[model samples]
Target: MENDAETEKEKKNKNNKVIVGSIICTLLVIYLGMATYFRTHFYFGTEINCVNVSAKTIKEAAKQMTSQMESYKLSLKEKSGKTEQITSTEINLKLSSNDEFKRLKDKQGSFNWIFGALDSKNSKLKANIIYSNKLLQEKINNLSCLDSKNIIEPKNPSFKYSSTGYVVLNEVNGNKIDKDVLYKNIVNALSTGTTTLNLDSTNCYLKPKYTVKSKKTSEIKNILNKYVSSKIIYTFGDKKEVIDGSKINKWLNVDDNYEVVFDNSILTKYMRKLFSNYETIGKTRNFVTTSGNTISIGGGDYGWDINSSEDIQKLIDDIKNGRTVTREPIYLQTAASHSSDDIGNTYVEIDMVNQHLWFYKKGSLVTQGDVVTGNMSLNTSTPAGVYRLKYKERNATLKGEGYASPVNFWMPFNGGIGIHDASWRSSFGGNIYLTSGSHGCVNAPYYLAQTLYNNIDAGTPVVCYY
Candidate 1:
């Protein structure tokens, strides 16, 4: 009985050993079979170039890639909200077979197939893509964005004058494409097996030379604002002429290079008009004489004469510096006052009709006397006009075409004409000038000539009229 029991136990142990050996043999065979299969086929969950090639043989992966390329189409998104397409057929695009798939499968290795299957195997494969360059360029050229009729050229930023001041204007972006960049992007898309190409994202469009955010654009805007900020007040006596942004903006502009430009000629025109309106020289004026008779006087080298060139340059500099100035323009000539009656009450008055002379200093009567003027018989009557005192001299000789007279006090106002004492003449004034007169001079008494020569200065207005 004991021998039989021991034989049973031995038989049970042998049966268990044989069952475990068969299970090990089966697992080994399956592992070896899968390892050999992975040598030619991609590991599970394998991906190449964004396409899944899991559990596929090299031939199978190549066929799948070729199939995808046949129907490949790239969508180009434009700035104009328009969509354009480039198909594989249009560019004659095809997948050129290479050993890259075999290399990828070898890199995974049969033994590491479990790791690849358990985890996602994602990779990028360099595709040998073949396409006709000429055909691709032709297709790109035929795009609607490249069409002349459909293309809207881009415009650079600019400066516009407004009520406030000069302001910077934004640029206009249009549907113009950069052909060279577009061509390169399309080839890149084909090489990577990409389906869509965004033209805007790829910077495939032509850009404006200057945008509102550009450094040069901002700089020019700052310059323009500074120029318009100038406030210049031109003073003429009690009157004020204001020049501010409204006027300055008219002269401001921007060039093609986004730089500030000013039209100097426009400012020149304004200056000329201002000068014409305000200048008193050579203009008719009203004068009240000592005899209480009002008279009209004209034709004189006196009163305001603007120095336009110097003042214009000064105005430009002031505006550039953004200066606020209240001043008067430079003048080559000026008068006692900037009024209709520019000649104040300080002058010498000679009345040819009355044949008398009077001198006023600061509205006060300085001297008065009877005087003999030009000889009417000789037609050398002292010309009637306005003039200034050239100079004063003592013990001077007055010479003419036929006569030379010596004088004690000589005050010359016009050429060859002056107020001087005539030692040869015993009497003066009245109609003595009708037949005999001391040339075209005011033949005054020694006392009157002495008073005038002592009180008068150069540039003192000498008014001679009938």
Candidate 2:
């Protein structure tokens, strides 16, 4: 009985051992299944193993790598198919980080979580892949310094081109920088020492200057010289006129046979030059008057009927009586004196050389007459010196001569050889006085002498000089 009981106990112990082994085996299987599920679920759903990435992941990794590139310098070997060189001073990148696995992993979770659940082998593999992607993208972005437009790209990507040939990349369309604004900014930057850049192949714009010439300087000099050297002389008669040195026939360089008319071109030029500044005084005309058949007066003198002795007696009596008779004195005017009322007296000056007579009243020239002086001879010539009008007569004649029915102002110039009335003479100009025709009297045209006689009193001053 004891032997049998010991054997039963050993059997029972074996069964117990077998049952425990089976239960342990089932539990191990369950645990293995659960661990496998968790590993597969986490690895496939949440854990990103960059080492075993697809093409999509690689591309995303590349973009993320490019995003991290900073500013850098670059140079182009050719421009527009030419062997010209271009350089970019500073450039920056703005890349998409979606393609880069390293950037994705770095942004996905903390380093502890990224490698914590990963096996050592997988962790190292993923790190190598992510690092490789980062390096590759960086190089690609740097090499892509020229964008699709073939322009040098910059960081921050403004639409402005730098002097160093760098263009801003990724800017909005139509957002180019203004040239003036860019130039101003460059100048400011240089002056303020904010940035340094080489300005090669730049054009400078400038405004062109112009010069002007003056013409009045020379013209004014000539006008002033003419004004300083000119003189003016005016003569009055039936019509007013001016005579100067230039108008003298002997003074002109012309042939002797050329009988120059008063209306010749040279004469006109001379007249214009002489009276360039003369102001008009007054004009007088020749007219005729008759006081019976004994006298006929016209122009500057009175005609005497030298064949009648009765006419001569009447002329002498009239002269002696007219000196005592009083009449209103005629007045003249001038610019300087304004009127002849203050001076109240007229003076006559006859110039034989110029054949002109100047009448002065109130210290100014009131009238100028063209006169025919006496013949230049010892017996019949009129004396030239200061004299006064002595007498006047309406009818006059010389003894044993025909009657001079009207005689005008008679001035005893030189012992009865003065200026008086003459109505019968025709030739008034030129050397008509060479013939000894007058009875020692300056025979003026009858009307002129009459007018002078009517206008002046017996004591009016008359100055005759060459």
Candidate 3:
């Protein structure tokens, strides 16, 4: 009987322990379920835009954010260090649940909410916003700091050439009404559910059209300085004309996009001035002979002609490269050098009226004699004006019109007409060619033709005139 009672007491003690443990586990499960339920709503401490939304559902949190919108304010700071405020009623702001709230709500879980509540951290949601742009602009424009008289016009930045180089003029950010950007600020603040829109921190203001800090400004300045700092000089004998930066600077221009534009009219006017001052082609000249005789001569392809098209490009290049040189101008038809008379005293002068010839060398008469000209009565007369010596030959046959004559020296200056030795003619000049002329040649003495041929070379000027 004693053994049965001990066994029964042990069984009773074991059953009581099992019952106490079962009660403890049941109470703990109830506590955990309640904590998870509360956490599923919102953590112990949660804030959305500084509004307490702890343990609240998505609809409840949205309701809390909406209530704060009515009393919201926007603080705008001006360039003059003045602060401006706008009431929520002015802009008609409305609070709305943004993606931030949805994301926070999606992250709430039974297991994760436990650790979040243990951390005792404050979680805040952004205030997504909406507002009327027109109302925002009206309220901003009505501010005391933004009055009509107080408003200043914004000026775009510019670049001007100085003595040193191209300099940038700072953009003038005048006190102007920036209703456009201020209206955007209202929308931004409403979207993010921000109670206070700070203009100073957000950089929301009226801005100038251009700024010196722009990359295009530097690009334009580089091009302007390249043209403005260049130098070019054109030389005319001892006189020279300089195209300096002051003149070139006038040709430079910057468009709205900061692109460089050179005014070709300025270059045209300058080139016109040069043409009027120094051009000498087609101008009448007073010709003086080697024998000290003066005659007026003009109207021929016998003077310097400026190559306007080619030289203009070269001049522009030299100016861009800053070249300073003293040399003769480029010419199309060059005549020795640009001076009083292109044909100097060192040339062969044939006086058809006097029927005389003079060979001048270095302003001194080297040879002088008479020469038979073409038969004028027969209409076979030698053409007048300036020409160049074509070539010279020795022991050449002169063939023309049933006549095959041979000469010791042949110096042709004009077409088939030339200076040659004629053994058939006994006397020269005095209209020897009037009836019995030797074609259109100047029949000099046998010795004179050889002497003249040996002295002058090709390209020597031969002035034939009456």
Candidate 4:
């Protein structure tokens, strides 16, 4: 009974060994069959040139790749959100078949086909793409973005004057194409057999040199605001001339490079306007003489004269520093008062019509005398205008074209004309000036000339009018 049981066990063990051997043989045959298949056909999950070629033979894969290349169209997504296309037919694109597929298959051996099937295998085979360069360039040039009429040019960020102050202008996102970059990306897409190309993603659009987010934009904005924020109050006696942002804004500008610039010519023009308005010298003045007659006297060099160039430089500095202050402009010359009448109370008034003179000190007549002005017959009549006293001298010899005379006191007001005590004149005043008068000199009595020379100060206005 033991021998029979042992024999049954041996037979059962042999049957089990045969069953295991048959299963091994079936798996080995299947593995060998798949390896053989992969020698000609691509493994599963294989891709070439971004095109799926899994389970396809080389001929089939090449045909499929050629068909895809024939049907290939690159879609360009523009910055303007517009979609455009460049087809293989337009560019005459073709896939020049090479040994790249065979080489790739050899590199990815059939023995490793199991691993390749298990994992994804993305193989890049340089398909040796060929196309007419001229045709491709023509297609690129014909794109909508490349059209001059359809393209909107990009604008750099700038500054604009608003109701309150300067504000930053936003940059313009234009549809202008960077042709070189676009062409390169297109060639790359064609070489890789890519279907869609985002022009925006490739930065193919021409960008503004300075955008609103650029640091230079913010710097220029701050600089312009600082320039316009200045407040300058010019005090002209009781009158106040204010220079604030409204006026300064006109002088400020942003240059092409996003830099702040001041228009110096405009500032100079503004200073010239101020000179025209405030300058008193040679301006027409309405004056009331001792005779109570309001007369218009226009010629004189005795009032305000502004130094415009110096003041313009100072104003530029002030605006740059953003300074706010009250001050007067630089003056080449100034008057006694900024009132309607620049000549104050103390002055020398000569009445040429009456041939008389009156020296007033603080609105009071310090001295009065009859005077011989000029020889009207000789056309040397004393000029009629307001002037300033040049100087006072004593024991001066007055020389002229025809005569030389000695004087006790000399007070010259106008050029070569003066108030002097002339002993040559026995009498004074009246139409003696019409015929035989002192040559353009106020021939005063010795007492009157001495009093004026002693009491009057230099630069005092000498009012001589007919």
Candidate 5:
């Protein structure tokens, strides 16, 4: 009875041990089921593409990311310190259901739940992406900054002149959108999953074609600036014109080889205008004689005539050399000082109708005489108008194209005409010249000729009028 009792006790103890072992095994199986829940989901520390995907299933992770992407907005900076944005809607940004996602999901080691749970490794994951490049380009093109109407063209450097003289003006680069560069950067950003695009930092904006430092622009600016520094002021008797470097620069031209060329026509025109106003001679004039006689004179070669062509050439050279000067214009003829008619008071006056002669020295009557002029019946009348005294001699024989005559004193004023001693005739003045008059010569009395010859000199003005 004792042995049977002990055996019974041992069998019951064995049954208890077996039941406890089975219960422990069942608990272990349940624990494994809970822990391995991660087998189909991401690891506790898993990250994909820098996004936390830990404790998320494959579809859950994809949906979460896709939803987040729909609200994505790319911040863009523009040229003029302005900010812009590119929305997902504009580019048709969306997730693509492709094998890439599955492959990434497989790389998570989700089947080895225990190992995945213990792993703390970081991973960069690329999800399958789908976006419309054409839509993105179109959206960028439609931006207000990219609009042609809103685009600002760059200005080239300039050389300007003012009261301050030559000035080098800087260029304005302005605002310009570069389609190719911007498109490239945007495409690169999108492909690489970039969130921000800086137009200024990336050099995506179009640059100016001519900058202040550009070689060609700088060269032109320098040339023009140097050209404008020369100040040329032209002056006539009372007229003046100031030609600064600025005006000369306008008349300058540069070839591709950078050779400077000045406009000769402009200079010619300027000289022509100057001559039109300042030139004298060939115009009506009023004169006052030494004897207090006011005469309206219209014929003479005794007035100012500017040398336009030569002076203009000289002006061009002065401008090219960048000279600053104040000067008078070149002239061809000169008139009397402070005299309007170009004829001063000291001159000889003769009246053919009255056959009279008068001489004045320094505006005072010095001598007077009566004279017989050329024969009127033969149309050899003494020529009338203004002439200068040619010469004087004590005793001379005068030869003409038609006749020769002898005289004691000769004061020839007009061509082949003179004041001479006609001792051969006893009378002077009046109509003896009608039938027996000297050919185009002034026949005077002997004593009168000596007096006139003693007073007159060469180059003395002789006036003869009817």
Candidate 6:
């Protein structure tokens, strides 16, 4: 009976030992499984709750974190609701083992503790992104538009960029820029967020090439008035009376009653002084009455008489010594003929074929005289053409006439042929036959020769017909 009882006790002890061993084995398996899951799933330094999060989800959280960095680079930020979306997925996985739980406890206390910590870090990062993006947007909004006020008008107004200096578009006239159009374009471009614009440099610019205040019309008008009043008019020939109002008006191209405005600048001060103190002998009058009697002095229809004869003489002297008005150089025709208006109507004409020269005044013959020709042997034939009596001298000597005497006058006819007072030869008619007859000169009587020499100028036409 004692042996059977001991064997029953040993069997009971073996069954109890087997049951304890199975319980310990099951706990060890659970611990190993949880440790493996934490090791494979959690990021290092993450909270315990993050341990059981999938690796794929962790990678997605890293990607979302990188977005903040990207936003900073682009000068932008995520919208307000976007922060919540990022944090919900990144903060909510459960802890699965004591190792993961210990990591969270040491670093962040617990799963609930880790969740709040991560949410706080992410919230701060999102706020920074938002602030940075707002600042960038404000800067872009405040950027100034390139309008007319800011656009630089280069010196001399050129369409091209010059490294050394500005080039002129139109040096003679002026420069014209459309400021209104330029301003409008700049404003439009800025409103639409455009980067650059095209400008035209080819427009012609005026003399004063620069940008000025737009409302300076009065200053511009003053400058123009000064320029216009500086002009002066001059006339040639004898001072004749401007008889008719219409004639004076047509000549001046102004109204008949308009006042003549003269420049009183330093350039004309001396001229004004001279005219104020002197008396003019020949009047340049602008007629105002119908009888052609009323006259005026200077440029107006008002008269000022001379104080004395001495004043008249002084005026004449001033005119003679004053600087002559010069005109712009003009090229004249090269033809040898003279106009009828140039030479006076009262003049003389010499006819070599008839062997006589005649002086005429207003178609009436005043004087006539006999003439001679040159000898054929010496090749001193009288030339046949139109010529003018150039110059003369008294008490002249005749070298080809074979004798030296006090001749009264010397008249060179054509190519050294001259008529002079032949005092040495006392014979007349039949060529006079005096020493080879003559050398192309026409010997005339003394009195007629003296009168002809004193009356002609260089431009007088001497027609010689064979």
TM-scores across all candidates? Answer: 0.60, 0.24, 0.49, 0.73, 0.46, 0.31
**Which candidate's TM-score is highest?**
4
For TM-score, candidate 4 versus 6, the one ahead is 4
> What lDDT does each candidate get?
0.84, 0.38, 0.72, 0.85, 0.72, 0.39
The candidate maximizing lDDT is 4
Q: Give residue 134's lDDT in candidate 6 (0 to 100).
A: 40
Tell how far residue 328 is off in model 6, in angstroms: 15
Give the least accurate 10-residue stretch of model 5, judged by summed lDDT. 334-343
Model 6 score (lDDT): 0.39
Give candidate 2 regions above 4 Å deviation.
1-345, 363-368, 399-409
RMSD of each: 7.4, 30.8, 11.1, 5.1, 12.5, 23.0
Query: Following a full C-alpha superposition, what root-mean-square deviation does model 3 have from the true structure?
Result: 11.1
Per-residue lDDT for 54-119 in model 1, tens only? Answer: 888989998998888888888888887788898988888886765888877777888676677565
Model 5 ranges off by over 4 Å:
1-258, 289-293, 324-328, 382-384, 388-398, 406-426, 431-459
Q: Which stretches in model 3 have alpha-carbon errors above 4 Å? A: 1-213, 246-282, 290-292, 305-308, 331-338, 378-380, 390-426, 432-443
Model 6, span 1-466: residue lDDT tens = 8999999999999999999999999977775665554443333334211212222233443444344223221111111111111121122221122342223223332233224335433212111111232443333333232224533343422221133222223322222335455445433333222333443321211134332332232333233232332222221233222112221111221112222222224323433343333322222423222223333322211122223334333322333232232321111111121221222344444444445666654545556676555554666756554344556778777665575556779876455666676665564344442335466676667767777777655444344444
Ranking by TM-score: 4, 1, 3, 5, 6, 2
Q: Write the per-residue lDDT of candidate 4 for residues 285-366, one digit (tens) a residue.
A: 8888888999988786778888888888888899998999889988988777888898888888889999989999998989
- What are the per-model numbers of colliding residue pairs? 0, 40, 6, 0, 2, 10
lDDT of 4 at 399: 94
